[model samples]
Target: MPTHNDPDTFTFFPVLIGDIGGTNARFAILLDAYAEPKEFPILATADFATIDEAIQSGVLDKTSLQPRSAILAVAGPIKGDEIHLTNCDWVIQPKGMIRDLGFEHVEVINDFEAQGLAAASLEPEYLEKVGPGETHPSLSRVVVGPGTGLGVSGLVHARHTWFPVPGEGGHIDIGPRTARDYELFPLYEPIEGRISAEQVLCGRGMMNIYHAVSKANGTEPVAANPAEVTALWSQGRDSAAVETIELFATYLGRVAGDLALIFMARGGVFLAGGIAQKILPALRQPHFRAAFEDKAPHSELLGTIPTFVITHPLAALSGLAAYARTPIRFGVATEGRRWKA
Candidate 1:
């Protein structure tokens, strides 16, 4: 646990940490160095006009803590001072957040970066094992998830430190390698004729699978959203919904296996985000594991790597708190200057 550091040790106090996604934004206040983050209710992104509005209305107004600095992990690419979400309409600017929100310092990072940091120190109780394998401390680890969008990141451990590597791996083209995929993927005409993993892995992606399954069956689609599709699968009443989830698990496993191989994540492959947590039962089925280990040339190598589902709800927030305490601990490269009081 990190105690409140001396002024010389850290430059901020009572910092605000946030995880903003396409669907919801979660806020928490770190009042002291060692205290747990006090979280507020999840705010729907569509309900607020801007990021500042969401923070002011949903966080600052509800809490008594006065935060001088804020570190937000947003669901988008972060370049310069502007952040434009790929899935949502909100645009975030760090300079504007400082000027209008009266913050002394503001830092924005890709949401999966935070998740990767958190993956470095997740407690055993917060994780549910997905397959058999061991996690080695000296090796690298990967975290991938599907929510409003797909997110991919990795943590590399070296010289007694963990470093977060963020990338838009989700945008890479997804190649079909199975019988179901051969039949299903053609139905998902690639976005601009090139299909990325996210197009068939995220929330909207699941809907695409559902619709594709329904069309293949020559039946009308029943569910209106991802949740409804999952509900139908959970009830075991709709064959198309069941097939949709089965495909989701299988494709996710393939993607995870590919990423694990790419990063050589011998430490583990952790599944994060809302969808993974909700669909754990489906993922545990044989289709997922079979696809994950189907890499013929490296099946033996992948079999040694563990896979898990991150069960902690506010993992990104916890990672931000860890970074705020000692930025060097997580070894994530962040850009921001401390504001003078």
Candidate 2:
């Protein structure tokens, strides 16, 4: 395979794109600049010892096309050559991928950055509006997702280019506000001392809320996992489960609203993750929007800022494909996050 090292004129043709999260890894291949991405089935991260093995068995073995470049969105910060996932055991080393998989170039980014990119360009059909508001094309936007962990990022449009700002916004401090929150907040399991947003916002966080609610009600917790909790909530048979889902929605809305205020994200605030999509009905309720617009002094401003749940399952892949096809359209910073042979 040929290699292109010139940063300004590099081409990412026949690219292998991946959205590697804590529990699952989704892969796809973009044949060229003009072709649509060919997607593959989702793979459990634990099934393979390394990402290269997973790619070889789950992607390369099934496709006839050879991918020269690899673009991966991982569930952690891009620190150095070796990237460790925040919630999984997979350690992604770009150099190892190039040496073992024979790729010419590799780029690793924070998973939420891909969501931010998708938010900047996703069409209306892929978005389900959560409440009433309009999108301001010229303003900034934010993307928050709660899956294996909480992912947060911001998108800004400047000089005709979309820029994604990725950070550990998931770890921001979150506190109780209402009387019910005061009763349940103390019972939640904290990471160290205080409760961060991720402490009660992700899959495990759902269970944390469930357990806390059960403890508050002085009843034994019935749900073992997030899915079971959701099922019980849907059936309305368990009060703890129902309250857990309701609290999760309210907390999500509060955090999203906080981010919207921070970025003044008039373009919109998008919710992307398994939990957000799975609990669409809960998010659509009045409580979610009420919590989102509860900001004092600026509640009216937030009311005009729209919120949406991203309906597309392969949204991160779409973002990577867009960047691979038209690199100039998005100002994705890849100084230390990119490796080339």
Candidate 3:
């Protein structure tokens, strides 16, 4: 397989890195392989016709240096050269980007995988602890979050290296595990008689939770969107919205805990994505950690694993830069296409 040359040796002073999501696309310039990345304003995905257009108008047209290599962490599944984003219409093609954008190398990967890659390297200020317990460096770490949809991935540590494994774990079936869970289940109709975790964990999930809670309490649902729900919850103006966010955090903790058990993530569980960052207070609630630690037989072990919310805006971009520098070290390029210089 062809490989991109070391970016540090390239004539271009900065390499391009991007994090594309349903709501916004963020681009940055990695001045050095290991230095802080310089980022541009977040571009609304609705404003652009294609991913290339966003990059061209937002980053390339504004910056002077010509980037030879690029890595984009997109919010979708990357099957091969062609990738379809989960929550938007943007389709990314690696070969087309290279041919049309004059890039020597271009790679696209799942957004959560990028978050997993950046989990270990995230600065202290960018992380906000959710529960207690220190990280076990030798064990795996799990990354899960909800934005346009829920994303799930894991990081494995071996031979002093970290490798990110991204997957569609959010589509797993979700059921009632507690009384609160049972109460919320009857509100929304399921897809094929089943409720995927994404149905109750993402932006739509929050709305579902709010509407369900309202119906259960004999009150008509009034919230318009997840933002409105969160805003109402923050201001303590809407009880139904508050309950929805509380249940959102609790259920998220339950899923995070389940994933931690699956991966034996003693290193930690990192809550990522835009929604996770917005609801830090809810995540810090006792119900959140309680649900996370409620697992039996291994509750002690679960208690030993710490959890955190990723507050860094450029985490995925940083991880892409890291992967660009040493793809083998990260071991994430096995599936995604890599254009060699």
Candidate 4:
């Protein structure tokens, strides 16, 4: 097997790009550098036992396209050969994939890293600005997504190349600020002993907040799941449900803002995931932006940094496609992540 030490010298054609999350695995084929990605139907991770099984049944069997290289963005940290997704049951072994699926090369990356790549490369039409600010080209940017789990990554422009920095930012600590927050926050269940950002900022996190809000209000929790809670909020029937989503947006803004400060994301802070796209009106409200700009010493700097929601459905694939097409434009570190046969 040949290791890819220099990203600039790396080359792969007929690439199979995937955005594998906890729930769904989306795949696409880039036949060549100039060809647009040909996407396959979204596959539920539960339907197939392994990543290769899903790809074979959902993608390879359906099309005549044969890809030589695979680029997968998974929802867990890329460490060693065997990759177990954080929330899903799928375990991705790149070398095993090369051995079983006949691929020449394989690259595995964190799911949010793909989101960061999308944020750096997506067009204006695919992004909806949440507040008033402008994007400073070539500056560092952050992408935060609240979904099955909270995903966070940073995109930095250095040495005339855009580099996506992947980390477990979702596991960062989060706390309450306001009086109402103080009352409700105590009710939230802690993972281990303390609450991380993912504890109150994801799909199950919405339920956590809902139950907490219900307890604080001394009301019975009516919503069964995150979707029902969002539905109740949308129908304007349940006050607790409303508070749940509101708190969710507020906390999301706070986290996004914190990441912005960490990276000094002057390029902009982009929000991805289904929740952000669903709660557009709530995110547009003053509360979200207010919490985001609450950074006291640098509130002015926060205000100048923009926040946006990624609207495109196949965003992660787009990012992989961009990197596949023009590898020189991105300085992706593939020293340990890339495998070959």
Candidate 5:
């Protein structure tokens, strides 16, 4: 163990959190619960050989930062103690981890679930509007993010209380809205056999959409990576890139709209993940809202729901911290009480 940093090093007490995704695990310390998260340090998970190596070495020193609670926003489906990180190379046992980390409270939640919690604590400056309407703070909020993979979760506010509902809604077969989108279905079969919404809405999915469209349209795509495409789209370099971003935004809107309908999250929608931040300009187009409100007849309903993108980079850490300290009351593990999620 590394020796703890001198007490004088930190002027305030911050809760330590790790946002572990399929590609990146963001480690941060939060001084203020969710309002403002000071980015202490960011580490590329690939830099370390193992997840534990990176976190234990960077956050757990005998001295500098003291976090009594910890929450891990993980990418995979959170069942029980054994967590399988979808985009990562590891599965974790919470009991073992909590014990080894020496944390009095430790909780693991799906990345989307954490994102939902993070959404509740966002500051006004940390958000960018993707569509045309303002969010109604009193209504339920939906959280969607696209990174190495697409993650979805919701928060319903009733009488001023926010309740988080986490699900594997991302894995369902995607409902393609257009003929060109129909061709995109088979393209994902080789990987998932059954394409989930994320197959076309996330990081790699952006490439999939680009390549699929390129092949379908018989036009050579100019961009090399999704980032390049997003950059070019933002700069108005390639119309095709613009088209790709449109498709991405459209599909994302479809998914969000669907989730909103499912959860009846009439309050608002929260868009997160590292991807949305990069594609903000692209999402401002007319196509974004068109897809969002394309709901049958009830299109007027979507118009009322507000959508906001999470601009805070470390926003999800708050959710992880909250998860660690809150106990599950039933079904999945309530031997004396219950278990689930």
Candidate 6:
């Protein structure tokens, strides 16, 4: 990678930010400070093999303003300085890469964390409203996305600002409501003794549901793979694929409702990621909504809160940038660290 000179003048061009998920990595060249920065041009992961190659590509070359800062939203756990990408072969470091990428400051946050940050600043247009009523500004907002894996996070509203919490909620044991889930272990038991929400809510989760339903129906269950299943569904040729997606959405909605119950996320619930976008058209279907509001006695409480699908292509990138601007306190985790005014 080649190093470039930074422009001397101080103007707010969009900070070069990125969000790298299991499947793809997206980068931006902007001319503003926020996630909603003006004049953004996006580039795909397939366009370049290495992140550095992608950053220094023709897009950044056209900008006379050299990016002095950056933030990357990467999926998987960040243990110390090194990041071992779960879905990809890339390994990244925050402090070291800053110098390498010609950035004065850089941050590589958890992908879910980036989503949490983006969730805080989401506008009405970026979301597709599912359930009725308005978001309760006082309630905690749950953000869950079923993509490469089932990612979960929450934004707690305290006095003023939204505090983002990043955790391994996906690894938590799923509330297996149906007989199929109870019997799911025999297939995935080789990997672990029991399955988590991620096992049945992610991309592979779709396959797991398809096969389980196949066995339940007393027939040979066939859907080529995740991609093939999605493709078939796209063309409206596979009922199994459709059923699998429906089950996935239902379970996902149930999980969201449960999270809301836990966090009292009356603020709202957001379905994010590429997978949600693909299934947004189907989410309007009956079964999906039924499973979501299937809560016991207090089911009506969920009806009061709103549910939405985040449709923005670079929603996570916006979050990664927003989080980057937050101040880091010397001690304890508390509010007043991030300012958006």
- lDDT of candidate 3 at residue 144, scale 0 to 100: 93
Question: For model 6, what is the alpha-carbon lDDT of residue 82?
Answer: 68
Candidate 3 C-alpha lDDT tens digits along 1-341: 33233443232435788889888898888776666677899999999999889889998899886777787788887787788998999998888888888787676778888898889677779889888999887789999989888989999998767878889999998789888778879876576888989999999888889989999999987789999999999999989999999899888988999999999999999998778888998888898899899999889989999999999877787667666565656656543455544
Model 4 weakest 10-residue run by lDDT: 1-10
lDDT of 1 by residue, 1-341 (tens): 22123343353778899999998999999987788888899999999889889999998888777898888888887776568887788998778877888777776778998999788877889889988899897799999989998999989987677888889889888888878778878898578997799989999999989998898889999899999999999999899999999999998999999999999999999999989998999989988778888888999988889999999999999888888877756665554422222
Q: List model 2 lDDT by residue over 58-177, tens digit each.
A: 999998988899999999988988889998898998898889888898988889999988997788899999998999987899999999999999999998888899999999999999
Give the per-residue lDDT of model 6 (tens digit) for 175-257: 56777556644554223676788888888887887777666666676676777777777787767777777778888877888
Clash counts per candidate, in order, are 0, 0, 0, 0, 18, 5
Off by over 4 Å in 3: 1-13, 326-328
- Give the TM-score of each candidate: 0.94, 0.97, 0.93, 0.97, 0.83, 0.81
What lDDT would each prediction earn against the true structure?
A: 0.85, 0.91, 0.83, 0.91, 0.69, 0.69
- For residue 188, what is the lDDT in candidate 4? 96
Error of 3 at 125 (Å): 2.5
Better of 3 and 5 by TM-score: 3
Determine which window of 10 residues in candidate 3 has minimal summed lDDT. Answer: 2-11
Residue-level error in angstroms, candidate 1, position 125: 0.4
Per-residue accuracy of model 4 over 177-275 as CA lDDT, tens digit each: 999989987899999988899999999999999999999889999999999998999999999999988999999989999999999999999999999
Every model: Cα RMSD to truth: 3.0, 2.4, 2.5, 1.8, 6.8, 6.2
Better of 3 and 5 by lDDT: 3
lDDT of 6 at 319: 69
Instruction: Mark the regions of model 4 whose C-alpha exceeds 4 Å error after superposition.
Output: 1-9
